[model samples]
Target: MIFRSLADIEALERTPCEQAIAARTTYGLIERAARLHGARDAFVYLPDGELDTAPQRITYAELLANVNRAANLFRSLGVGPDDSVAILAPNIPSTQYALWGAQVAGRACPINFMLQPEHVAGLLDAANAKVVVAFGEHAQLDVAGAVRRIPGIEQRQVLWVSAPGAPTPALSQRANEAVFEQALAAQPDSLQFDPRLSPERIASLFHTGGTTGAPKLVQHTHGNEAHTSWFAHMFYGFDENTVEINGFPLFHVAGAFVYGLAMLAIGATQVLPTVLGMRDAAFLRNYWKFCEREKVGALACVPTILAGLCNQPVDADIASVKVAYTGGSPLPTELADRFEKATGIPVRNILGMTECSGLVSIEPLHAPRVPGSAGLRMPYSEVKIREDGVVALRGPHVSPGYTDAARNAGMFEDGWLVSGDLGRIDAQGYLHVTGRAKDVIIRGSHNIDPQLVEDAFLAHPGVAMCAVVAEPDAHSGEVAMAFVTLKPGASIAGDALLAEVAPRVYERPAIPRRVVVIDTLPVTAIGKVYKPALRLRAIEIKLQELFASQADGREIVVTAKERGSAAVADVRIAGAEDPALAARLQAALGAIAVPVAFSFS
Candidate 1:
């Protein structure tokens, strides 16, 4: 249903004609910002190694100049309209220049600098990049290694961008690649905006998944990014005085579009907290101090960092912080309450994906903070809750499609993108994200919802945090296995939690078969629980239980594979000369309703 816009008010008034004119091109943003706030601080980066020194500052004029030079460099390299330039870098300042400049020259493809070489290589191949801009050795990125993953990708095409202290990439000289700074030296600092260039031209490509399978490259145009950045900039009431602290990796969609580019849109100062930006302990510890010292007005963080921050003692008066926005996962009501109580800034829950220019909905600055909700939809976006409670998005900010056409099929149905996230809209119009629809655990005929299971455990006195995922089984499909972190000091053993939490789920198969207590649950860079690791651990735990005592001389590994709605297990016990041992293992697995096949080494 169309959200009633009659009562919905926009903080910044924009006539239809004016909105159309402003979003003409990616260069229009930099041009506008330079004109409006040239002398204002555009980006401020705080180094993690040494906090005693003044934070690095870049004025809007300087940022624009750098962007123009970068665009010129790309042009010199023969990159033109619609061509893709792949950048493998972290959250550093040059990453921004690479982002906008490459887009101005061609299309910018930002890789998750943390992804495996093979995955990154696959993405590079999909994006069809003609050139690679890689950060130097100090960023800890294996730039050459990743490039090596792609066959026939000549090293000469790579432009190694070195940081202040970073050494030249090991392979740069041998391949005759130009240094980024030196490459721009001969290029002119000013670039003329192409009058013929349409704003709808593809500006960037961001990688999204491996959620269902291999990651797909989502296409974002100039207009798509412009609309999203402008929406957030105007919505937040950002200006020359607004100093926002951003720790999200610039390679991520949320990081580049919402946190990074949005700042440039308004000419607001962005504080890059650290290289180890997200959920970094050192940064979180000094958050309040940095806020008070730097006059940081706004900041964005994931729910996991917020949870950890809530646990820290708030000793400083952080009156300078105007707001704190959270996304990337559901913000637990309890966590939100604790954070607000400790720090006066409201933690507005938001939900977004890589496909939609990185924002679906956020709690507007003008409105009262809605607890436990992802807040209202952006004015440009049309959101519909599907019959099955799955959230769907369609708007100007929505991506045109993926780079890989094979992966594009069924991605969008009936004009609305299946967000893959399950959620609902309340009567008041606030959206509540439940969980990922694919993360459901299938046990026999019953669907074991992970969010439902995890939420129940979150209420337990001993549990600090919890994640539920399906572990492959020999029989009855997949069963729920919970990995939990207990509250500090008030603890009980992991096995005891099974008995305590079992009563919450009356259905036999729904109850988690195992509760593995952990010092901390594995989390993604964005702070959501990493379920894939837990699934692997589940298989490992089952294998260990069967063979830890039985096989002391050799290694035994068990794997779970899906077979339609049910699953089958492959058990390999090394040097299984004894047929009776296989029988014992099979019988044990069978007792748990599992069908397992054993192979001897």
Candidate 2:
């Protein structure tokens, strides 16, 4: 069905989802696809992410068989329905086998390999991982070294995987360690045991939020995953003939479920870039050529990628490309418009969360781009804006809750998942996300949304990316501060740029007090702007400005660090300790939001 609007989605919902979709589990969905399109190409892996390199293709039948073999192998290693299998690898064909195979046998936990060793260990311990499938030694990432650093990794079953034709790294002999290819080859090409798969069974455990404190492992039931994949497939009008470029890492929800499983469930071919994925410079430089060669129908990317693609010349034929899907962060209107004008491809925004199995709403490919809207909710799903403007959702696609029930307090209310995003449901059933509730800056009694300030700056042609964060204030609790990255060859002073964009911001209090220009903005692994680092930088700037007058041939050094949940700033004065100066600095900083610690050396 081609979903043009919310009405189209509602029309399809008249028939219950259970009646509409025969497959109730991810395994069932894949099995059904294999039966229908067994000979079709399921995945096309680019070995070196080069257009000239010959790609390795896997058929649906081979994919299902490998999944079955991996499941059987896991069962032999003592994995039960309740146990979890952890996979630490990039986007690879074998990673897909381990992910689905683990789900068939038990639950799968795909860990972010970019995380620190301690954080990775914490996630493994939290998920109670029985088996770990890690990528072998490579030039870029030290997967083996990170796995070895895990406290009790030696006791767990470890299977190593390498890219096609890549040499497998040798590891110290351990009773529990084995090469994944050799182990998987020994297993039969069919299921050895009945999984007794059910809709309510946990399919995977996905980690969300920052990896600083306790890890938040979101539990996705088979029903949650199956519904989301099916809804996305139907919404985007994907079929066996669709070929898409999927460069997102396996650990992210967008890669694992939204764009990954959704395409596989329909037997659509997914072209995976090299282990570096979109980060590979050579691949990005020749992205259009790859698309033309592959005849890609759907383009998967984030906002940052769109901005980069805007700079890349359209050096090849891209008439086959129909749509570009972008999420992981708010889509800047300027970037979207520029991309569409450059490549003539419509950019659809997606609103998703780990708790929702990767989807809440997606702009249908059949629908025109809405300026600020995140598009309509999934068919048969419920999305309502709270009185306070926070978006709430409830449906089969929504996860039950995190593994740690305590973490679900503010997020989950009864059956509705309280999305922390501040948004409004338009009269047309469109969701327009304004900003995050926690991202709001408070100045005295007035509350300001950072997006307003960011939008104002982004309206300028010189600004490439902008992030507005809360800066500590003496009188008011906090104020807005903006950090921006200029376009290539664009040069403008911070004060002049701020003056040019300040008029665009309607709210006076929402205007940023200071503007900082940098070569690039801090972003997460998936390309979303990281605001925590910006907030810390703002705090340091405010403190440095406050204490600049006290420097009498004494170097004043300011550093900020997150202590538990609060941000603490340390100020070091280079000289003999002066009680008066310290007292003044402490009093001045105490009035600010972040706590300040004074040290003289």
Candidate 3:
């Protein structure tokens, strides 16, 4: 099933998804792989993320046995088909066991442990987690401390997992807590009860990382995960011989399903970098060497990692590498071209969302790169660009809705899940994502695409990463502003950089009003530029400039933060409050989208 175009995908779908995919559940899929490729390596884990380090290998049969043991352990802990088992860990083998095992026993809820304890607690509470599988204390992250902080967590069964050779952190003895290895070892190495596997049964609850609101938990059915993983494996042209380097965190769909489970379903080996994953600087430095050593046939990464790889020297025999896949953020045309030119491996783009089990479209390995295109939609999936340019998709891969039905209002329309991304389908069926619908900069009545400004800035050789956001403006409601980070050893004045790139932005309104150069752009755990933070910075800057004259020697401080799902700007005055000045400031700030609050010191 070498998917070269939409026609190939359509041809495959002609058999019907139910008939095409033999295994409908994650557990069933792994069982099939284990039966077919029992001796094949399923995973190669690099403990220290070093090329010379001795790696831990797990065979397909071994992996399936571990999954069964973990599932039995969870079921023994009273986790039912409707119960949720929450996991807080990095990219360790135990994390994978917990993820798939919980899916077999109950619903797996993989939370971002990097989030604050209160936020994590909220997610756990939302999912009604009955058991928690968390990592023990590590130097990089205080997972143990976070777990202890979760209110009422002591009431639920807690299993702590520690990497081999890592010391267990001492904590107050709790009756509900137990060592994960000890508990898992006690369980049978096979399923003790029927899974009652069904396509409609909820398999997992994935928290969506929205910019403003409390994160929404997406419900992925067994069918959703099965379809997405199968299609991704087909599109990537993966077989038992395919080996990919996957460092993405398990909490993300790209890591758990797209790049992770997709490879595992076919007994393809996935090289897990380390517990820290891609964030380990040393591992990134030796990424190519490790790939060369593993004979990796496919490279799994995000656009940010790909951009960094462009700077890293390919000092190893990477002849086995056929192609590199990147997603998570918009793939800049310039960045992709530069990487492909620097390394002979072709760079393919993937467009995904949590709602669709992390996949929507992927550029087939056999297809040539299409500039500015995210690639073709999944097989048997319907992708339509609304009149307003919002991409909407309906397919077996699509999740039913969010755990909180209210959050699905604008997201899930009819049977289609609105992507919130502005895109167009070409005559050839390629989807070119122009920009985020919400990210569009509005000036007066004109709408400006931020990608236009970002692409212009990225064209400069000195720029490493560039993000364009809307800055609050009293005159035009909001105007475009660019935040850029320069490449290593590259130096240029912000004004000079703007002067050089402004003309390249064809749209007058799309041209950024100002450019700010920073040492590094704030990014998410997965390295996508955190635009909400930049937007807040932009709003704070505008507020400071707007109130500077009105301060009249009184110290003026402006701070911005998300209040509930709304962005709020807090203005503090040094002296006693003056009603006249407060009224004036309130009237001026009212023009902006963000709500403004006044306070006096």
- lDDT of each model, Cα atoms only? 0.74, 0.89, 0.88
Question: Which lDDT tens digits does candidate 1 get at residues 1-601?
Answer: 1222214533222446245435556678877998899999888876563447567788989888988888888877778886888998667777778888898889999887667766776777778787888776654345556655555556438877665445655553455477777776677779855524465789889887633236778988888788777767545656668888888876677688787777888778888865566545667777777887888888788866776776777767678888788888777766667678877777776777788888888776666777667877776567888888789988777888887766766666666788887888888777877777888787887877787787777768777788888865667768889898876676877778889888876466778888889898777666667676676678767766766566655677777654543445687878747788877766666545446787888
Where does candidate 1 have its weakest 10-residue lDDT segment? 1-10
| Residue 360, candidate 2: alpha-carbon lDDT | 89
Indicate the residue-level lDDT of 122 in model 1. Answer: 72
lDDT of 2 by residue, 415-521 (tens): 99998999998888989999888888989989898876787887898988899999998889898999999888899999999899988997888889989999888
Error of 3 at 403 (Å): 1.9
The worst-scoring run of ten residues by lDDT in candidate 2 lies at 207-216
Which candidate, 1 or 3, has the higher lDDT?
3
TM-scores, one per candidate:
0.88, 0.97, 0.97
The best-first sequence of candidates by TM-score reads 2, 3, 1
lDDT of 3 at 201: 98
Task: Report model 3's TM-score to 2 decimal places.
Answer: 0.97
For every candidate in turn, the CA RMSD to the true structure comes to 3.9, 1.4, 1.5
Tens-digit lDDT string for candidate 3 (440-497):
8889999998887788887899998899999988789889999998888999998999
